[model samples]
Target: MGAAWLGRRLDRTIHAISYDSPEDPLGRRVVVRAIERITGQPRLQRIYEAYLAARRDGDNLWQMAAEYLNLTVRYDPAALAAIPRTGPLIVVANHPYGAPDGIALGYITSQVRSDFKVMAHAVLERAEALRPYLIPINFDPTAEALRANIEAKRAALAHLAEGGAIIIYPGGGVSTAPHVFGRATDLPWKRFVGRLITTTHATVVPIFFEGQASWVFHLVSRFSETLRQAMLMREVAARIGAEITAHIGAPIPFSDLTSWTDRQALLDYLRSTVYGLDPAPQRRAA
Candidate 1:
């Protein structure tokens, strides 16, 4: 195995040891106190306390999942500020690095907008660490679970109706392509993002992350992608060594969504407008 892989194994072992020990009450207390001192924000401190309480209340699984991943976010403040200040915006981005990406984006959006909430997977919603900011949009694995899926969608729509800022990964869970950067071809099929924007009259902010997680993590990421066909396992891979760098593109106004029937046209418009691409020549239908 490579040195990086070995290092990752060591890190996981350390975390497992620390986490599995049931007699570390004092140690846990000290760590929590240290976090409180470092953050110095009463609200955030309260959230941390709630996380501990939730963990003790049989929510340890989600806490462990969150700790096993890491995130590194980068965005231009000037560019972010230039975007129009519209209430109830839907922030959409390519799915990269699984839950860590959501947590990082959640934290950043929480900092930028007081009413920020994420339309996240139900598994992610189970996380005590992220529950404060995430609003679960459950995705059922069975074709027979369409009703449940519709309920989740309705809840998301209601949240937007309430003037809440939402973060959505339109590609769902399949867009976290491992290895390489700037491979735009890997993006998944566009879905209800445009319709959601059009119906809700919410502005769409397209974001791009320029970097992905470490290669070792990518190995495991691909494994999970194949075995479970879900990207949840990327969180485990990230604990070893995986980082992400984000780029926040400009926002698109809701009024410019006339060609709702044309998927490629809508996608191209989003890419060009948000990522600052020169307009492509209109394609004739083959």
Candidate 2:
């Protein structure tokens, strides 16, 4: 029963990626399969299977994703405990590893509050298992991203206004080289995060993931952005059974951010604050 449900969901996700249309030719379908095959479609199916099993057994989805990926997430219990239990809250983090970091966030924060939602890439919305937790933003430049993001933006604000929590990756894109000299660091964070912080008066909790993807991952990234995205699952496969460390900084109250009048300045400060959580410089060394 679970396998059947998972297959249907995967089909829907793939068709969505294909942008299903009657005029879509056989070549386009071939391209979709080729891309999917390269992007660890089989491995992702296994992960999704595990997720469905967890849902069936009434277990946590985040925990299932972590375990299936062989990721052992460790964070300071006191830091997590310090999160504001009730009120409008925005958890900002660096996007180092593509999917793992998001899963780690869900696992970490779900322990504190169940009312939080994550702002994620729009493709993830196709996963029925993940829909409840994600507020998707279309990052495709070809699409009308500003218009596409409006609904998600409104949903985030409404959630915060109701005293719910939301998580955001201010960098907007994953960290990589060339974009930040020789190092792997988040791309210049978007100013929208600052706007959300100020607008909702939400307490901001900055969290940093401790490592980067393998050298091969970054090397391929230098060639093509699309190729880099396709290699995300390969990165996950490489890190299987790896201990993923997360550092959670003290929460910054909205009052603390009010003084920063400039949008870029506010985003720069918040980026620094999150990156500051890294305990060692060598961990991110290229």
Candidate 3:
């Protein structure tokens, strides 16, 4: 049965039993006993309660993070206002910083539309603390837990299919690098996002963030690169101060010509747009 259906049935059954005649203390006791029996474990009731509480906590943290970041989103107000009503826009942005970037973008999207989701990394998803607010994308091939990742990806696709907006960091984990500090040279363009937009026929909105993290974090990033394990770099970057200002570009319509070549062209277009907006560096690289 579907989760929504099961939840409805559970709610209806509980309400029916609890409200039945109101005077029968025996009926209320029976309802409690039924719940214990249905759950099949004495500990399950506590677990369920704890899970709900954790979900609320996760949501609260997400809200607080959004407030803390306070991203100055520079876009045409008319365009921003049109996005929620337009349905299922694919928000593409340059990944800067580790924690605040996604949080700020997600918050901005939420302000525009209620039906929005974020495609986050598997590590963040695995934290039971954050799982309630994050839909983890499993990129690992060796683990059997990837089934959840598959389900999450399907959920994202279904949300888009139903005309819901989604925020994705196409640069993946590398954008979280600390050394990226307003530097124009390190941006790595990945092709998966282009494929997603073309396959889903969603309009692409490019966003750019104009800052990065501290040098200590960059040292950790360098260490990870040397060890050939870059995933941990995001966590390192998050530890230090990483602030960014986000800028949204004009939307690109999906079409038949959005092949790999087209994807590269789009990436180039976005890169050039961001590069042009970046201030002239105080000093040129040696």
> Which of the numbered candidates is closest to the native, going by highest TM-score?
2
Best by lDDT: 2
Model 2 per-residue lDDT tens digits across residues 109-194 = 88888899999888777677789899988865544677779888999999999999999998877788664235688878878787
Give the 10-residue window scoring lowest on summed lDDT in candidate 2: 15-24
Error of 1 at 34 (Å): 32
- CA shift of 50, model 2, Å: 3.4
Cα TM-score per model:
0.61, 0.85, 0.61
Which lDDT values do the candidates have, in the order given? 0.53, 0.78, 0.54
The TM-score obtained by model 2 is 0.85
Q: Give the lDDT of residue 3 in candidate 1.
A: 50
Candidate 1 residue spans exceeding 4 A from truth: 1-72, 83-86, 174-187, 214-243, 259-264, 271-286
lDDT of 3 at 247: 62
